[model samples]
Target: MARDYASRCSLSPVRKTWLAAAAAILLAFQGIGAQKVRVEEELEAYPTESVDLRCQFIDGLGKTKLTQVSWIWEPIDGQRDNIAVYHPIYGQSFPNLSFRDRVVFLQNSLENPSIRISKLRMADAGRYTCEYATYPSGNEQGTTTLTMLAKPKNSAKVVTVQAGSKSVVVAQCEAADGKPAATIKWLGSVGGNHSTTTANGPDGTVTVRSEYRLVPTPADNGRDVVCMVEQRTQEQPWVNTVKLSVEYPPSVVIEGYDNNWYVGRSDAALLCLASANPEPTTVTWTAASGSLPDTVMVDGNKLTVRKVDDAVNTTFICEAKNKHGASKHQITTIVIEALEDPSSAGVVAGAIIGSLLALLLVVALIAVLLTRCRRQQRRGYPSSGDSIATGSGGSNGGDYGNKARLLFSGTSNNGSKNGTGANNNGPIYTYREGCDATGTLTEKANDFHHHHLHHASVGNPPSAHDILLSGDIDEPERRKFDLDDSMEEEEERYDRFGGIPGGGNMLPPAYHVRRGHGGDEEVDVYLDDDMESQRDGSVISRTAIYV
Candidate 1:
């Protein structure tokens, strides 16, 4: 009956207001009990890592004794599902088929009721709530958000696009299996044009590919090209880099020599330098004109000249070779002036002849001087003066005229006089004006006659011209004889009889007469044997007589 009256009775406006106030007070108390369960607002974890959805009872809240712990999952676009539940008497239970073995409840203490999700997946990333039931404080609930991150797999590759074009390639960068769509970018030495594409994977992941078309030059060789992947959850971007290699032909250069080269010297060297990707396998030296000298020696890049000469004045070519190609450089060896000029045979011959002629002239002059010295020695006289006498001589009484005669008698087979004529018995008469130092001239005359006879007894005799020349004297009182008119007659007589005018082969004889110291008295007379033999010998000698 009290329940019927209370159900039929209507309260006034003030009583209704009081009843609403009472209800509000009860709701406020329940809200305070719900606030006692504490949970994190957000939670973050990687895929394959564990995530905890915690719910705890606040201390001093009068809800210390726990009865039940229930966990639920709310997806982004799906219905709420029960994940796990626990009661002290019943242990733990998984209510959702999808999260059955992946969810667990923590029961370290009655005050804390938290659920952990192991090996979290993209599907597990959602809002989770935990509800706690206490005996005296009723039930309290908390919610937490779970975030799962999956890193993208990044790769980079450089592939050759064509043959004979190693310098050109395609640089490709890819990012796969990313939870969210990944952004791919090409950096670091990528040049020219490039393109990007994105794909969705079956496992709710994204894949991004970036292909950069590159035409690399020689300068870009060995450089790095990078591909980077950017994702929302990653702090550092994913990077992939590739290095480039380039090949080319050889570059040839010659060094170690200059224009200051010369012949007959060892002052120059030639060096061959080749710059190539692959080092040159061979180096050679050659001449453009003449053949290479035997003195040239090659040691790697160095070409040494053992001796330089005219043969080296040609174009020298240095050839270098490698796998790529061959290259050559040519240089002309310089030649300088020689130290000695060349002379012709004619000039040399002329010099020799002139030297010989001068030598002959010198020899001839020496011979002439020697002959003069010998003649002076044989004459027993000084070369340039007459001999002085210690005494003076006066004229003698005997006839001593300047007439010389030569008589020759024809000989029979018996080597004796063949005729008994008056000329044969008497001495041939010869007159001279000169007188001996003795008062008589008979001894001087006898001496000259005996010399002539003795020479005639030998084979040779003086001609009539020589007899007449010997008779002439240089004294002021003597007569001068003219030979031009009478030379023919004397020559005729010499040819007819082979002798002088006396008819005997004898040369003109000479005499020397010395005077006595007291007066013009006879001292001595001597015949010269050289005058009897040599037709050119001096014919007169005199000595002074003291007064």
Candidate 2:
């Protein structure tokens, strides 16, 4: 038994060594089969920023010695290329010229196998692959996708968008070259319908064009129209703005005057105001009827008044012109009234003056008629001789003939001779008293005593009784004497009584006579030729005679 036990112990050592070697081989095979490499499926970065693409081993052989590590990039439209390589003992290498200075190993270690790119660009977006070669493990690989996001490039232009029935365009906005199919919208001062058109680019980007149609009114002359672009990755939208300019004709209006106007008393002015897309270039003022005076001044849009007259009544036009079109406003001016014309006033004054002159001429004619009537009242009768006599000179005579001659003297009651002659002593008979067969006498005095005949042709003085008895002593000679007396009296009467009513001098009686036979007895008498008296006494005549 001792010999058998010793041999068994020595063989136990060899069996234990073989069993440990088998267990070691089995663990190594299991580790090689379970090796795994992992990488991120997607990554995101922006331009000019840093990004890390992850490629690392999640499960692999324990403490395996890695020989090689390499990175590859496959672009969306191009072939794959090696970006960088790593050898455990040698160092790192970058094989691709496109990513030479931009790619680097993370922490300068190959265990992680992650690449960090500095200053990323849009072109750098692609699929990245990492490969690893290790001792006891043949190969391991991982893939990651890198996506680059950039701000969209926005552009805008004003285009004529046809909308409604009118052939006019207000505004248009378009956005292009946006990633992830950017949404386009419009924001502006005016509200209207919009039309959108989208197109895909050769790259995986979308270009959006949006057209906004608007009907601009006068209130929307200058306004801002904006086109906004929105992407999935951006927080704030990209925008393109343009100022909209609308073109239209001018709307003209006139100011600075009311409707009430008067000639020669009203002052007025007119101003033109226009609204248009482009400012008005010229403003003109004109009249419809007559031409405006040279004194009227025009400055810019204002028409200033210099003088107002009857010619101011007309239609006024204010015209404004711009690039689009022209417009005009008309105002009719009228004259109400003024003071009376000077010529009419003068005519009225002349008529009043003529009326006053006619009244004065009528008054002067009346005054002349009244003076002539007063002169006729002063004379006793309608005289046919120059002088007048009134007296009581005859005494009553009984049974006298039908005709009797009365003697009178030529002298005035004021004791002054009337003519240029010497006084006569003899009594001159100037009148005859005639009685019919019934003894009724009528006094008839046809001639007055003439002062020129007082000194001539008085040869004898006859007594009153003898003059009454002698009827026809010498008929032809008495007729001759009466004719001469009438001629002399008529010539003297015209010389003294030119403008009086009766053809006789306007003076008092020239003689006084007594009606009784005695010289002391006297009677009152009147010198009217038509008066008659009857008495039963001798007739006597007395005359105050001058020698």
Candidate 3:
């Protein structure tokens, strides 16, 4: 019915043209929406693996029709070639001989035709176009880029070199046979520079190489260096560490010469120390002034003087030689007269010093003892030429009233004086006042001495035996005397107990003393044959008194 209406309705030429152009524009928009093709623009696969190059045709409104589909290989350096084809009548076909056995069409339909290629090689990496022939849309195509990935084998090695002034290769790193060229770099604190180079293989793989350069020295030996390689196939950079080896000539040093080589010494030796990469081949000893002395012996790097003498005094040269070079060291020897044994000299000096120290200590002890004795005597006795007399009481000869003239022999006095004359032997302390306690007697004597000293100031100081005594003394001085007296009493007790307090000695000395008792005084006298007489006609005795 629409066709009959269109034929009956006639139009002018201009109107017909306008209607035709509108119809054509409406059909083009419909074809654009009805037919669409899709393909992966970029794909990646490893070598020797299979990959699907997908191609799909979409028909909207069920109006667009597909006839045939084909895959074309567009190499980067060559013209296009048909690799795979599919048609509704002819089935699947592959024309390229290289991919004839490895490629196949995935779908038989003309709408969605995809090809799978197996056992891919590096040469197969290029652009591929999926072309489709349709009923109304004519030819529709999409392109895909197939990329092949190949991992490179990386390795690094160190080069052994002799020490030199010029720069040389010390280490090398390589990334071999990769699909894309790999980048190489050197890493380390070896203070060296690196250079990179590339190589092309016939199989479309690239090889990258790098070398580390440096002026190597002996100090650089066993130094660590690293090489790194980066490639598309690896997620992380490949790393390798290596150690460099360097050789150098010998360095020499001399040892074992203590500069104490004296005449008549035995078994003295000098040693030569040499260090080198290659061991030293020879060691020789030579004299600087003349031939080696007869007493000297040479063995390897050691020179020994069996019996040292005046002839052994000379300069010695030691040369250590190797294939690389030679190093020399020298030492001069000086001989002297035979020296005494140091141990003997040390012993003699120590003995002399010890004797002198002991003598000094004894002299100091004697001086201290003499000073203490003089101080004690001054407190206990009166000096020479001082006379002391009893105070007058009732003018009669009572026990404490008589003007008695007393003569006392003290440690500081040569003799005693009385109204009769001088007496060589007399009582040292004569107290008319009787006291039962020794302490009370000492107190009374001290008081009497002080009182008499005050009264006798007009003349010389009164002797304790000549006047009534008064007591007035510093508290500190009195305490000091009390302390000295207590210490002396303790020492006497210790001596009586055989040098160990409260213990008795099994064997005692034969020395003896007889103590005489007066009214209030202690008189001890020693009568022994070994007594020695003094200038005052009194004898000093070594007496031991036992309590």
RMSD of each: 24.1, 27.4, 16.3
Q: Weakest 10 consecutive residues, lDDT, candidate 3?
A: 393-402
Candidate 2 residues 1-547, lDDT tens each? 9999988767577899998999999999887566467788899887789898887765533677677889989986578899999887788899998799999988566678788999887778789989888767678888888887765667777753312345355656555655666788888757756788888765455677777677766665567788887887778987888666666778899887776555554367778888866789888888886577564678888876665566767777888898778999988776667565544788989989998898998899999998776653322223233222222354333322212334343332223222111223324433332334333323433232342223122312223223333453356535423433443454365464343376533322332121322132112222233222223211222221111
For each candidate in turn, the TM-score is 0.42, 0.51, 0.58
Query: Evaluated with TM-score, which candidate comes out highest?
Result: 3
Better of 1 and 2 by lDDT: 2
Q: Write the per-residue lDDT of candidate 1 for residues 1-547, one digit (tens) a residue.
A: 9999997896789999999999999999887765877899998777778877778778564536778878878886577887788777887788788888877766655567677778777767788887878766677778898766678888888753422443344578888878777898777744645688888765456788887766655455566777788898779888888675544556778887777566666757899888665678888888886567787888888888887777777778888887768888887777776554334567878899999999999999999999987753532212223222111122223322232223222212222221111111122222233455222222112223444433433322333344444443344312333345444544444454344566644322332222223222212222333211112221222311100
Distance from true location, Cα of 254 in model 2, Å: 2.0
Error of 2 at 78 (Å): 7.6
- The numbered model that scores best in lDDT is 3
Better of 1 and 3 by lDDT: 3
Quality of model 3 by C-alpha lDDT:
0.69
Clashing pairs in 3: 388-466, 389-466, 447-469, 447-470, 448-469, 451-470
Which 10 successive residues of model 2 have the least lDDT summed?
Answer: 538-547
Ranking by lDDT: 3, 2, 1
Candidate 3 lDDT at 237 equals 98
